[model samples]
Target chain A: MTDSSVPATALEVRLASRPAGWPTTDNFEIAEAPVPEPGPGQILVRNKAMSVDPYMRGRMSAAKSYVAPFEIGKPLDGGAVGEVVSSNSDDFSTGQQVLHALGWREYAAVDASQATTVADDLPSSAFLGVLGMPGMTAYVGLMDKARFQQGDTVFVSGAAGAVGSLVGQLAKLNGAERVIGSAGSAEKVRLLTERFGFDAAFNYKDAPVGEQLREAAPNGIDVYFDNVGGDHLEAAIGTMNDFGRIAACGAISQYNATEAQPGPRNMFQFVTKRLSMQGFIVNDNGHLKREFFEHVAPLVREGRLIHEETFVDGLRNAPEAFLGVLRGDNTGKMIVNV
Target chain B: MTDSSVPATALEVRLASRPAGWPTTDNFEIAEAPVPEPGPGQILVRNKAMSVDPYMRGRMSAAKSYVAPFEIGKPLDGGAVGEVVSSNSDDFSTGQQVLHALGWREYAAVDASQATTVADDLPSSAFLGVLGMPGMTAYVGLMDKARFQQGDTVFVSGAAGAVGSLVGQLAKLNGAERVIGSAGSAEKVRLLTERFGFDAAFNYKDAPVGEQLREAAPNGIDVYFDNVGGDHLEAAIGTMNDFGRIAACGAISQYNATEAQPGPRNMFQFVTKRLSMQGFIVNDNGHLKREFFEHVAPLVREGRLIHEETFVDGLRNAPEAFLGVLRGDNTGKMIVNV
Candidate 1:
């Protein structure tokens, strides 16, 4: 009782203010607080890592979304890799590495059921990347929702990001005849083809996406997974085959615009080509989760699936990490070490 | 020799010239000739009616589709209702009423396998309305593609036309809590509620679609089957529930526009609502054909499905019928009695 009498403690980072436009480093602030003892069904987790995604930018804004807005003065929540330090539930115990939804913080006291026990063989961080929501999204949208067939041509936008990278690779492994990607930099384009097994990749900034996409997918695309919507979507539409399928996962280009812009003007191409463009939130595709892990885990083990992690030190840098992710600074998965 | 040996001639209507903008009477010409003789698997049908759709406007403009465009100085082929006069294959029998693909003129010779026997109880015109491609398009888009659920709210544009009328009624019968429709005229709005069983209907011109839609679906739309598209789509995006689905059947508003007049301005609504909008061609849902017939035939026979047909007296009026259909002059399906 000697050590316990002093009471436990945890360090937390919270949303201090809502952003006016693009969130700055000032939007977040660190705070010191007492770590409460786990009360029934809850577990105390010492977070080791957390995820930063383009979607998080919307959460920071007051605008509505499928998920609720982040409450000011409360810590933001997203995918996190942590270790259970103390548990009051049988579902979690000390020393067990876990993945949960705590973010921008050093530690968390959360319900045990909220945490998922990732596979022992895979990197626990993978639960935040290829084996988690992003990976499942790619798998479901490409295979099940798109009804993708072998030998079909595939295209992916934001191809160097965690989700898009897997989308490109998985299409190849699934026997797609050709896989193309669009990225922001030469290095990313090269990485897509050389490291990620994409048949072709382009620097969207240098070339008009439509012209570049036509060159990459000479025969036209059968399926497109869109992460960066705007012009990339416009270009993809120009090269889509009759009855092509587009999976709208995210629109990074339109995320931070202070001024509104009409996007991807080629949307009418949908009518001419008789295409199907579906926007889906991945978690609701839960029916495919088990299948995604089964398919992707083995591919990772065989070294066919390659992923990159860009790490930022400390939870205080979480805002910067998110900004970087949205700006496409991260080569692959953007994560923070707490 | 018997008159039958003379190969009784059939008059055919061909597109004399491409229309300047909206088609005029000068664009079509009918010529009488010998009735085509049936080939090994073909049948000669005495065509009762022929339909004209807005999509035919694109076909007339030399644009490509799953089906070939109408070549200038040649026949404009589309869905036609006819009765088999002679059959050269086991699939068809003489004197049986059937539906086949034919051109604008009376009397057509088609492959017997391409013709399907129509129920004697239903009006021949129904084949082009609630029992044909338009009906199947609305049915499959709502039931299968959109995954429309019971108790969901639905919004449909062009709600008095062949496709949209069926779309609204099916939504109501399939357990929609609120089935709202938007049409071009006050009369169409009235018909939508009284005839099509729409929970509510509005004249899009009377008020901005966004405002009307907000008032109509305060709880937000779960499904939107878009035939009008353009402004209606923008409004629908604004009124969509989280994870709402949109089936893009047509965009009549932009169909005849020479230039894409700055597409919808509210693109951010897609990201915020996590809405899914998809376009489809009827052929893509061919697998649903039999099931569609099974589901809709009973509703039709029971008078639960009400269809409208605007018929012209002769092939000479085909051009006027087509122009009228596109201008929203027709209450539902527009056909020619050739």
Candidate 2:
């Protein structure tokens, strides 16, 4: 049985076409579909909020990647938190809030095994940003992938974004000697230093990243958490200290480029400076999820850790939110309030 | 005390001036200096052979690097094996074969503590090549830096060179499923497959490194020992499997370039493929020396590990030998036999 609030039809966004360079609204279609009925061992969810992340851009391409590409004509999916309106399984009851990976829609019919019951302790949307995938990505990329040491000086690119913001803060909290960051705008640069506690921050649009990074990290950076690749990676390589490590989390700057970007010119520094760079995907690192929540959740609950969400009001505007994220329109996490 | 066999004056090669790009013989000066008497705790040695390595090219440049630049008008020093004809300490006796770092000179007054007595079990020049620095570089780079696994496919650039040759042979010995190599000439390619036991070999000059590497390692390479950077490094990145590791040992292709060469254009593969690249200097890895020697020394003695040296006669021709090594004129370890 469906809840009285359940609508007969719901709006879901589907991939209409693959993007060659930057994706536009034309790549997506918002269509009405009947709210799905829960089969045996399934739950029907009325999604309250959903995530619109940078990584979703990769799925829009037809290329093979760590995750499968979004199929044309099918509704796209990602992280979401919603209330279970109907349940065909004993594990979930009506009115229970759960987190699942069936987003980009107003209502979802999810397998009980794929959904996890979440408490109402914090805003349900918090699970989409600070307490979820982005958070774990920040934790693993810095602590594990970069092999961050207590006395290291860190430099993070795209510093005002979800993962970059957390990486800087975590570095500061974990005894980094200094934390420097780079962002695309003056406002984001200020936010990085003033709000996120970055020791120094720069607007990458102002000057060559190499010159700016050199100015900020005169003594050189020991760890680099990379979110925006291309120039930022080259700059970081130039400014890295001997034996420095780089955690290549994402390359948002290159994701939309029509052609492959040239990498750092001074890669010889890798040999001369004895540097190490590693890349990782968050899903492959699920082993760190439990430890991540145990460590970061309480800090977040106590208001010691801060997060921001730029919410778009409707499910139809989810495509807009995603496009905005790609264009760096949002701070912290971009969310769709369905 | 001085050795009776020591001449009144010996010829030594000195750096006359730093080179802008490819160093010429004009950058060097062969000068005669008096054979010095041994001071307290010193040994007088009549040199036998000296190493001319690709890494020496870096030292000839004025730029800051892992090793100090070779000073103008000062006799250059490198790995050399010779007979200790005179000693002023209890640590050494007359006519003892020893290894020390006082190459490019026919006679040396070396500190007894700085010289090591080596066995005559193999050619003494072996101490300067296969049983010495180059061998240790290959060992640490492959086993520790690249983290080679059994059944992994390994690729080595500049496969006919000192370090690259050892890297391929070691990978084969360690149970690599396949070993691929790239060299500059058809002869060297033949040597890689026939002499070095490489599964496949290519002349990088004949075709694009990416195309040739793809043809050779269709399943993709797991480990890459990068001795030639620039195009070779770019190709390796393109052809690497998920979780591939690159040991950035050297960049001979870029050493003589006047401008900093552009690095691999496909660095996003680092993120998509979850790859790791690390660089190292042999001196900094002294902790691994004992283990490397213990593991690899027996292999050399048993004729299981093969090596070749292209020897040039006379100290005055050391400059030509150094220049030749940079031009890929040597098939193996290049040495100046004094």
Candidate 3:
């Protein structure tokens, strides 16, 4: 057979249906489309790795939010790191590696300006995890939103996940007096203290989160990096010190609930403790990108900061990778290698 | 009766028992004690007026908070304005009017350092309402805590009461683009728009707060001064614009609820909208007192800022005045004329 016998089509994952509670494989559809041509100021990328983040769950629903919902019968898009295969712009070369928001597909045609060029020294997939959206989220939420102090006691929920793991390490490196974390499993709890250098860690399933948090932080926490909402938020509020601050990045726990969950019943604790809580999206703080990279890249390059990834191979498996994120079945960043 | 037959005792209101939920007359005890004698660095004041504020409800409970709980069988203390009848310190004289945290009593023996001398131009009782804790709470909550912008659309809950009434007026005078208020009664709603110069006012008791708020502020609110929490807080969250700020000064609606009230279930709105919520107490922000008086005192003297009071005369009726505050029975500041 000749080399021309190989198919030239690209595989993509599309939204087949809106989810009712928890999304299943039925919600996603696999399809093939002709590879797109790059126009002026645009580049065609062959995606190597892509992210499946918790925030994407909110975008799946046809609800009013900061970002628009993913339309049905269209390819899903998110953080992706890939090699430029065709270029119609002077800024990007055919062989250059870049990061862009065009994932769950084998090929992407995007404006050159939307694609950020990455350093060649590290693995290209690192841009989809620790060097990309998740990294920036941890930095902005801790330094800017929470106003983390040098000696503050910090508590992080979802400590085994990508953003949460970075948040705990950053707090420790910045001289936090004590760093406490809560994870979903015992193995994740062990990884938090031993691998991430957390002062204390606990599995939330072991006991009531409020009691466990109180025990983990007997002196009370001054800052809380909230990734999981619902019970975690309630417990954090209960154990917060006076004039505490909470940086709300994500609420992975309640993202797929069919009905509205009960909120923190003891919200009055906010008043009594003079607490300040602010919710933020990393996209809003893009101005801090230069500062974030300067501070974190060195630590990462020197092996001072650790990062992990759980990869699911092939574009067809992207939907399962995303579902795994919602189920907390993977640690660190959940990505699909296309 | 002869002039010599007059008793030289001072009447005081004491907490007879801790309130289970809502406080009643039976929770207070009327007692008489000899007028206190001033010691070195102390002054004996003959209190003319005392404030019954919403925060007192929190103090009646034994739960730990920013301020100490009111002890059983002990005199209740709060904001008071009075004449310094006996002074052992050089800073004060017998006829000087002053304000101190020694209310619910006819006479108070307080350290001279704890008493703030009032300007002679305004009535003495003004120190307990417009020029005292309530007034400072409004200024700090708006300017400092909420970071109110000059042209923001402002919404104040419990808008006919002491702090909320002033919050709306200040937003107006400070060049808010639009000022909206929500009150409990139709009369109070009318007073908010007509007397307080709010652009729009709604009676929350007349309709669902969420629907009414959306109608009142079609463009959405930029800042929310939350005095009445529960439904009002929930509705404010529902109607807030992106990057909106909430100053949670009080939660009067839930103060008397026996059960833990459900919080704003749509708190995820905070994440999508990038909202910041802060809870504050005026006592922690005493440094703003000078700036507050400098900005507001002239407005009061020039008839630009209005002051209203609902007076309950005599120490014996102090319990009723406090009860009325919790029930929203009076408009503006509820004070006992001792």
- DockQ for each model: 0.45, 0.86, 0.76
Candidate 2 lDDT, tens digit per residue, B1-338? Answer: 45666779889999999999999999999999988888999999999999999999999988889999999999999999999888998999888899999898999999998999987888898898888899999999999999999999999999999888899999999999999999999999999999999999999999899999999999999999999899999999999999999999999999999998887888888999999999998889989988999988899999888887899998888999999999999987998899
Best model number under DockQ: 2
lDDT of 3 by residue, B212-315 (tens): 99999999999999998888988999899999999989898889899989887878777889999999999999789889999999888998888788999998
For residues A1-338, write the lDDT of model 1, one tens digit per residue. 01232336667777889887777878887788777666788887788889988888888887667788998998888989888888888887787888888766777778887888777888877888888777887788788766789999999999999889988888888899999989998999999999998999899989688898999888999998888777777778778998898877888887777876675555666656778776777867777777888898888788878878888998878788888998899988988888
Worst 10 residues of 1 chain A by lDDT: A1-10
lDDT of 2 by residue, A4-113 (tens): 88889999999999999999999999999999888999999999999999999999999999999999999999999999999999999999999999999999999999
- iRMSD for every model: 2.4, 0.8, 0.9
Q: Relative to the unseen true structure, what is the C-alpha lDDT of residue B55 in candidate 2, on a scale of 0 to 100? A: 93
What fraction of correct interface contacts does each candidate retain? Answer: 0.40, 0.89, 0.76
Q: Candidate 1's residue-wise lDDT over B21-120, tens digit each?
A: 6677788877777777777888888888888888888787776765577888887889998877788878777778898888586878898778888889
Give the alpha-carbon lDDT of every model.
0.82, 0.92, 0.90
lDDT of 2: 0.92
Candidate 2 chain B lDDT trough over 10 residues, lowest sum? B1-10
The candidate with the higher DockQ, 1 or 3, is 3
